[model samples]
Target: MFNLDQAISAWRRQLAAGGIKTPEVLDELESHLRDDVEQQVRSGTSEEQAFNSATQQIGQTNVLKVEFNKVGLAKWWQLPIKLKGMLIRILGREQPFPFPDLNTFTPRGLQTLELAREEAPRLGHDFIGTEHVLLGLMKSEDGIVLKVLRKAGVDNSAIKAEIERFVGVGPVHEANMAIPYTPRARKALHLAAREANALNHVHISTGHIFLGLLLENEGVAGHVLRNLGVQTETTREAILKDLAGS
Candidate 1:
């Protein structure tokens, strides 16, 4: 008594429990699974056997979760702000949102993130904050971000000094240990992807990252920028101009 519908339902529940909770994503995965099973069945495999083979082909829950997460962020970025908020409310705060893959970032953009990660430990902090991201943007040379900052009369060295002063130094942690992003930092990155998408860019760039930091204007980076007399609108315009030119 192999009940195909019941078995698919059970499989969907398993995926949900394994962190594939988005309804749209779940539906898409289920569709793929069904297609695979149907193909096998058409080729003469028993229905139950086809089901098992399809599940195997779909991949383990953990691997599927990671792949879906990578796709999720891009899809999330395309969502309108209001729709995103509504979806967030429906999903609740208990589930962790998926972040985009670093591979989507351009070389200089990836460098900024890496420098931010390194800056956290160098500053004796165990977590990467928006402030660290600011520092990383400053440290990155020859990037359009630095060019925009220079055009805006913002001194990179001064910004770095200010961030260090604001954050201060925490107790030392192991350099090799992975540091997680603070909520603000994560939001900034999400905004960065959104910024790139708005411009119809396929890859996230350093300028987009800077714009992300600026958009998260209540964060430490925003506070420091304000203290330095840097206007968010002006800086945003400058970054946009640079991006357009390049």
Candidate 2:
């Protein structure tokens, strides 16, 4: 007889052995396994047959272990925690800001990210980071994030043009070190370097970018979010406090 819970336990053990410790990731994995087993049982297979089939379909746990280690191996979750804390400090408890979704961070979606990196030198900023990226998006006439901000009555053109002009008079470098990001890959890694610089944090973090997005231009992100009817300031603050406590 196939023991569903036992199979789940085994999978968890396998994942843990592979070095994945996040409860959220582990929960998601278990959910997928259960779904696979249930699908097999629904297909006229015996419970034991279903269990065996599901296990096989799941592929080699060792291979999965290796893959997960590659992607989630670092502190990928800390960036946003820092960003939320900064946003709370600025926007307070009632206002809300929406972090750009995965879709919005894509290279295609974030064309301004490249523009921001290139523009940083002109602005006399020694480093190109997320703050510069926020500045970049604000300056870009073609960025969708700018379009969203426009809907909320924020005119970013003045600041955008100013940054461009500043870079025009500043020292320039010939090498291209911009993160090889696609407009479609919303990783926002282009801003990681900047985030680290701004917060004086030991490592490049997502939270700094989050703060960059929030603090740049009188809470431009928060304002745009308010227009969209989402209350981010408080919810994000709570999330920050929770992370800090943990």
Best candidate (score: lDDT): 1
* lDDT of every model, 2 decimals: 0.75, 0.46
Across 1-246, the per-residue lDDT of candidate 2 in tens digits comes to: 567788678868877777766676666556656776787688877767776776565556675555445432232212222222222222232323333443434343245656666654554333344435656555555433444345445456654544343323334544255322221112344343344444444443233344344534223233343444434454345324432432
Q: Score every model by TM-score.
A: 0.60, 0.31
| lDDT score for residue 112 of model 2 | 60
Q: Pick the candidate with the highest TM-score.
A: 1
lDDT of 2 at 176: 50
Clash counts for all predictions: 0, 23
Cα lDDT of candidate 2 equals 0.46
TM-score of 2: 0.31
Model 1 poorest 10 in a row by lDDT: 77-86
Model 1 residue 235 distance off true place after TM-score fit, in angstroms: 0.8
In model 1, where do residues sit more than 4 Å from their true spots? Answer: 1-97
TM-score between model 1 and native: 0.60
